[model samples]
Target: MKTLFLLLLVILFISGNKPGLSQDNNLQKNLGADNKVKIQSIIFNDIETGIVNNDVKKFSQYLSAQTYLSLINGVNGYYSSNQAYYILEDFFNTFKVVSFKIKETKTAESVSYGKGDYYFEKKGKREVAHLYVTLNKAGSKWYIAQISIN
Candidate 1:
């Protein structure tokens, strides 16, 4: 009897009949299968390049007509695209940008968000800020819908 029970246990183990282990393995496989590639737009590169080069006009061209902007000085509101450009210009003048790079990006349907670091030189000292930009796709083009710096 003991030998028969042991053989049955070996068979179950080799056949992947371990309840929790098989369930966990299936879960992991499902998760891995669900992780699909995300599609991003070329405008994202243009925005980041404009920031790195400190070109206000180039950056502002990506902003939508009604863009929401949140500044570090507690200013948070929606502004027209032209107004947003001026705000960005002011920030570029106040803090000299040394480097800007996108850290991560996520897209859902028609909108994408990119988070990154914005390095600037302030008063002879280097400063770092978290930059998050949201781009919305309209028809066939993507435009900047929101920008937040913290």
Candidate 2:
């Protein structure tokens, strides 16, 4: 009986030492992920508003240090945030936004993509184009890493 008691005690000690996944830890991690998704959604909403209103000022704050843009006007490549701002400003000035709407969005752990419709008029010629933007999370903030209007 003494030996059996020692064996049981040892078994309990070993099992208790195991770091099996805890429900609280899992819940915390899930909440963190939910917060990130919420942030992505909010940022995308701001970006959509900016595009719809033809006002980069609405979302320019989210531009990454170096942003990649492929504009219909033939400006393509990575550019500084300041340069990207002016480039987008120029595009908006020339195209003239009739409407902009985000049709779909996908979010991952560290990146998110938004695809939408851009209806614009150039010198009274109205057309619609596909708009795609990528957002990358750095630290606790999301930044616009890429924008393509095709």
Candidate 3:
């Protein structure tokens, strides 16, 4: 009877420990994911507004120092913060934005990404382009790391 009771106790302890280890792994995976939802919303909303209104200053406010931009027919490459600002300014000048809408937004770990559609006019011709932007979180703030329009 003594040996049987010891075995039962050991089994129960092992079972409890297994679940705790698994739970800990899950908790670690989900850590740092909370509190990002609101930030992502605000940043994406600001981006949408800036594009729709062709406000380079407002858009530049969120750009990372190493921001990269790839446009369909214009500039394409990694650019410094100031260079990107001017490139965007030129793009906006060449194509007048009629509408900008975000279709999807996703966040993983320290990175947030979005996809949308850009409707604009260039030389009296309407054009539609797909837009993608990726943002990286630094401390308590998010910065636009890359942008693509095609």
Q: What TM-score fits each model?
A: 0.69, 0.75, 0.73
For candidate 2, the per-residue lDDT at 11 reads 97
lDDT of predicted model 3:
0.82
lDDT of each: 0.77, 0.85, 0.82
Candidate 2 error regions (>4 Å): 1-37
lDDT of 2 by residue, 43-71 (tens): 78878888888889877888899999998
True lDDT of residue 53, candidate 1:
84
lDDT of 1 by residue, 63-142 (tens): 78999999775769999989999888888777788899888888888999999998898789998999999988788556
Between candidates 1 and 3, the one scoring higher on TM-score is 3
Model 3, runs deviating above 4 Å: 1-37
Collision pairs in model 3: none
Which has the higher lDDT value, candidate number 2 or candidate number 3? 2
Give the TM-score ranking, best first: 2, 3, 1
